[model samples]
Target: MEQIIERIDQLWQQFSGQAAADISKLPQSGSDRMYFRVKGAEDAVVNSAIATYNPHIKENETFLSFTESLKAAGAPVANVFAVNEEHDIYLQEDFGDRSLLNELEEKGFTADVFALFQQSLSKLAHLQIKGGENIDYSKCLTAREFGKQAILSDLLYFKYYFLDTLKFPYDKQALLDDFDALSTYLTHTENKHFMFRDFQSRNIMVKDGQVHFIDYQGGMLGALQYDVASMLWQARANLPEEWKNSLLEYYIGEVNKILPNPVDPVMFTIQYNGYVLIRLLQVLGAYGFRGFFQRKAQFLTSIPQALKNLSAFTGNRKMGIAVPEFDKCLQFCTSAEVMSRFEPLRADESTPLIVNIHSFSYKKGIPSDPTENGGGFVFDCRGIFNPGRFEEYKTQTGRDKAVKDFLEQRTAMPDFLNSVFDLVDISVAEYIRRGFASLQVNFGCTGGQHRSVYAADALARHLRNKFKVRVEVKHIEQEAKNWINP
Candidate 1:
């Protein structure tokens, strides 16, 4: 760590003729690269920049070369400010912490956010088309170009790491034949544009509400649709179907603008769908390797979402080319019985018992406990003043501020929750100490839309924050309402 700081200090002095003020390490991501924010002296001309230390000198060189090439092509990429004598440590412009994904989560999928997506896709087309010119292919990290070899590498990655690990029954030789056919078909794309190997929301930064991209070190010469597939189908983003179609059309339109002659829409659609399948399988392989094989909790949580994506993709659409064995394998992978294996762990057999809490209508009966133990506390919130009785609060649920304030101010809900918290805290502490697994808590009321929902949400939040135990919350009646309205 000290050596890295020393290197950054040296680079700072060499570049800006000033001493370093301080260096702070940034959070690590999936990649092996280490980043630090280097601050300059109070009055120094050089402001703060991100300094990266990568052990892979070849990848560092590729990144530096790509940065220069892409920047000259008018792409919104981070500029390399300086590099040490070893070429392993370099400083680049820091584009702050906000990402497009963060923005989408903070704000909903509105016009403003969609506009950003539009701008991003427009820039991406330029990055692939204009940025492909005069680039040295020798500097590519792995394959000089994305072709049959690269496609097979991804398919084989899925096979060995994910598919084989699942131990699902299949004709191995037949699947291999299908894989070869699929790869050969995808390689016949009309144009070989620059492929940003891992183009997704997290890699896109939003500075002053404008989009800028980072982390293109793995880029290579490839078809345009691969990157498009990567962005629109990013697992966590879970973009709405309407938004996905709109954005895809928007991207193709942008690509047509820059092309000397527009690409054939029919052929482009076929190839694009093929690439989507390729990207989905590649991501599933990644999640399986990181989650199932390595036992990382975050990656494990993402499995169901990815499975959901695969299910939706295969449900209605078919690739232009048929690989029957691959289709059957995909069906098996997405089957309900198969997906059940990847569902997140239930608390019953695990340490630090997670309390599953729910709000439900008494009329609909209480929700059944999913845990094997099957019994815990159930509080009736019908005794409290009903927020749903008031017309103003009828449409609102517990999560809304108006409903919360009303429950806390106009009623004795606080006293009710205070007593409940005191009771639950006892069991929670003892469970943690004894390493017991599951607990259930329920709140019920007449309508289950306001008071019960509020109480359940409150208890879930309190338990999570106070005791640091996992808490899963469900609002049965409210969820039904959302389904009806949504």
Candidate 2:
């Protein structure tokens, strides 16, 4: 890999690269799979380089054909300039560094931002372009397998993290019963459009103040609401409930304008809520896996926020969907009786075990049943009581950065987190001794607000289901006080 990178640099310097144009400071960010940037003869080149090792799309003629098709369909994608199939390298146009996330945070959102988002949706609705004519949504794991795998992630999350990592053990029958109910709720839900899985703030780049989509490899024929839920319930760029509703309507309007058969807004909204729950589960597993196994901190922070947002949506009346099992899961999070079950996991040791059992002290009402109180849970077993252990992880700016990254990664945590949590559970059970476990699980954005509080509650509830001992969930910064009484 080092030699490849060096060789690429050498070739660029020899060919298209120029001394006058600095490529070193280009706004480059990516996953382990690929990375690239804009290269220029001077500093005025309109093209960029997209280097990758993804064999599926790298050497295949399908990628080039896909780009051509996208262009024909009037999609605002980067133009392919050059390709090195063997090495998975391609030079393309440089879209600006400004993301919808940056724009909304900096200048505050405007009609233009909304309009661009709408336009992107409009283009997506009529995505006549095909990367390959034989593409089947069912053949891929994303569509056919997504529904089952996604729901399973939530069960696994509740199993490992809440049960194993946090040492919350419960009766086997109850756990199975709980999961069965949840599974039934998830399976009965309807499906919708070919969704751009990560269609949210960060992926939707604003180049020249126009929205250009990226990170769309996971696209699938799925639910429209899932994408809508993702855009609105996204951790990093969370809009107010009112704004979220308006955006949903706006997206539906865009779809209606382009499609031959107009979609029923009410029906779309219902499906969207179900997708939101599925996405949340998938996100938790994704984040947990990334954080625990892959050493990606960004995934760690997203789990709480994603779960909280899902909890709120399940209970929200405007959603008009009854995700009963999801609501039950949320209710379990707030049950003091449930959280107390983690007491057995706590060890009597030199440093005291800090178990934080959570409740709805932040958001006033649960979205599942608007009149009912349904907040998520938080379980922090990290030994923060020790100053030395605490100091090791504390970094001022890094905390803020972590929070930001968490918000960004919110929609993709459940599946990742479940994988991580499962590994942690298996590993810990095999190796770590029964002793003090101190964890700090934060579940909020910009103070102890809606998403954070709800997630904290869910985490707590999940922990309770796993253990037969006592666990405490604390709202570190909330103005109000609400604790579940066993």
Candidate 3:
């Protein structure tokens, strides 16, 4: 890691003619590429850029070439500033920390967020049609085009990595025949467009309120519908059915404006549905390979969502192509029995831990243990200022607006919570990863009504918003009305 950091610094210096003021490593994604955020010297004209290092030279070359093509076609893509083919390190425009997926999570599915999705799809249509022009197919990482073989590869990816792993009953030879039929049916579509192989919300970054695309190293020439399908059918996005239909129409309309001739609505719908099925299955295979086989908990969390998508798709309508065995496989995969394997832990079911948080008066003793395990964390809040000592706030509990304001503005409660977050985050994260069943966190003070209550509520909100985990908050001294469950 030290050698890699030094090399990134060297690359930054070589590119900008001065050393970077700061170079920090970025988090790794599903890909093998290592990323870094490099800031130019304090006085330099270029302030910052994203540096990427991949061990594969050929893949880097393909990405560089594709990026240039997409940019030239007026797509919203980051520009490549420098390249070191020998070291397989390159620099590109930094799109910052926000992705469409992050935006959706922070600000739910609002009109403004949906507008961004519309703009992204409009730009995607342009990338598929205009970006394909004057591009060299020989530089592609896999097949030069998404042809019959490529379609089959995705179907088989679903079969071996996902279906077979489930131990579901199916006729192997019949499924293979169905796979060939499906591939043949899909490959006949208008496929000479630039296909962003893994185009999903996570790959679309929102910088300065505009969407910028990335992670197209696996892109190749393919049908236009495939990219659209990849985006709308993204497992975790969980886009509403109405939104999906409207977005599909919106994309088709954009394609009409870009293409010399418009597509037939009927034919387009048929092909689009076919691709959606293909993409959904392909992603389930990916989730299974990354989650079940590799034991990555993050990927495992997505399996249920993907299965839900498959269920919705298969239940609504049949694909135009006849593949009875394939349909049978889909039905089996989306069945209640198969899906239960990936379902979130129910109140009655065993697994995925729930955190129980309580606020209590130290004089009255700590909250009683509710789980089979006898011990848990108890944080003392006595070091913090007591808002209850003040006359105006004496009668009010932590949930009251005045008491909340006092704790936030006047006390060291924020600092105390930050320190507590630092400690508890480690355990909460590890517990979720290991599939532990329960965790109890308690905050105690002179009285339960003020400091302790405030701390418990704050921690519960933080855990739910950050980890999407179940947090139940209780104020022991308050009435039953003060209890919160989610």
Candidate 4:
């Protein structure tokens, strides 16, 4: 990987005629490709570019072709900068670290973020219509078009990856027949445009105070409905019903204005809803494959949210046609019997131990234990250097970056927490074996704004990760006012 970074930096220097200062590897996404943000020593050609190392030569070729087409059609997409001789390594314009999903998650559904959603939909219409005009189907990474076969593939993906993984019983032949029926109905729609196969908030980046798209390598000619369904019905985003409805209408209106002839809004919407069901099922299949089969904790954790979103659609599935077997599979997936496994473990009488954690100020003394069993550990954080002494972090709590950095870098907080974790682990394990219901661990500092709060939160995280026993945390000082995490 270090060698790859060196090679990438060398390539950037070769292309830009400027020495590369640093090449930092980015986080791994769903795809197998690795990425890095390459910074230039001198800004000759460009200051920063996203360096990609994908072994799939064909996929890389398709992405380059699509970007050129999307760029020509006024789509908000990054430009291809350079590609290596092997075609495996390439450089593209960096849209910065902030993606639309990052914005939605961090700031939530603010007015500005909502507008970005709308803006993305409006541009999507253009990407599908104008940007899609001259796209050579021959250059597509997979299927030439998202026709009956393609739609059926998505349904089958859900069936094999998600449904088959579970021990759910349903008529296989009948489900196939239903898949054929559904796929045929969807492909019969008049509209065919470039469909971003994985169009979600994460793929859409918010750069230069505008929305820019990434990871559209799997794009193909399909109805606009599928992409819209992918974004609005994203399990993680879990967009509000009102926003989904508004965004869909807005997208359709944009499409109508661009196209030579307007589509019937009523019919288009019905098809859109059908695609919503398809997209949801397809997503579940992906989660199951990545989570259950691959044993990825991140994907496994997301199963509940995906299941929750699927149930909302399946509960009132007005698809204008019924597939009893498919419906049965959907119902089984959303059933309480299956969902219970993903839910947090409850602390019942027979369930053994529950650890109650608290952070308080020395001024307030130790917090009182709620349970009848009152014996536990109370660690003093006053010995540790407090960031509260600094004026810059005076208003900030332990959760804030400045205070957290101060505590972590300047003080012996990490060593202190490591020792605390060792002590807590013993009692927690023994308590679980002995069927102990409660354990109270408190951290007290001068103000509870810096040291104690950080320590308590750290210990809570440690316990949650190390043990299956239920853990509860309380910041008495923060609760008295409110918490701050930034």
Pairs in clash, predicted candidate 1: none
What is the C-alpha lDDT profile of model 3 across 1-486, one tens digit per residue? Answer: 557778888888788988888887776675678888999866667789999989989999899888888899888899888887484899899999899999988898899989999999999999888988967778999889899999999999888888999898899999999999989888887546989999999999998789999998799889999999999999888899988999999998999998887998778888889999999989988888876676544566688889999899988855688889888888899999998776643322443678999988888898889688657689999998888898988878888776786676567887788778767777877787778778999999997888898899888887775567888777887744444332
Q: Tell how far residue 68 is off in model 4, in angstroms.
A: 1.2
lDDT of 2 by residue, 72-110 (tens): 666766676556636455555556678888877876667
Comparing 1 and 4 on TM-score, the stronger one = 4
lDDT of 1 by residue, 1-486 (tens): 668789888998888888778887776676778888888876655688999999999999999989899999999999888998898899999899999999888898999999989989999999999997867789999999999999999999888878888788899899999999989999987789789989998999999988999999999999999999999999999999899889989899999999998988778878888888899999988988875665443465577889888898889666788888889999988999878866533334346577888898999997887677788899999889987877887777877776786786568887788778768777877777777778899999998888998899888877765656788887888788782222
**Deviating ranges (above 4 Å) for candidate 2:** 6-22, 25-30, 43-68, 109-112, 128-192, 292-298, 317-326, 334-486
TM-score of each candidate?
Answer: 0.73, 0.58, 0.74, 0.74
lDDT of each: 0.85, 0.51, 0.84, 0.84
Model 2 residue 151 lDDT score: 58
Q: Name the runs in model 3 displaced over 4 angstroms.
A: 85-87, 348-486
- The model with the greatest lDDT is 1
Higher-lDDT candidate among 1 and 2?
1
Worst 10 contiguous positions by lDDT, candidate 3: 342-351
Candidate 1: stretches off by over 4 Å: 41-45, 345-486
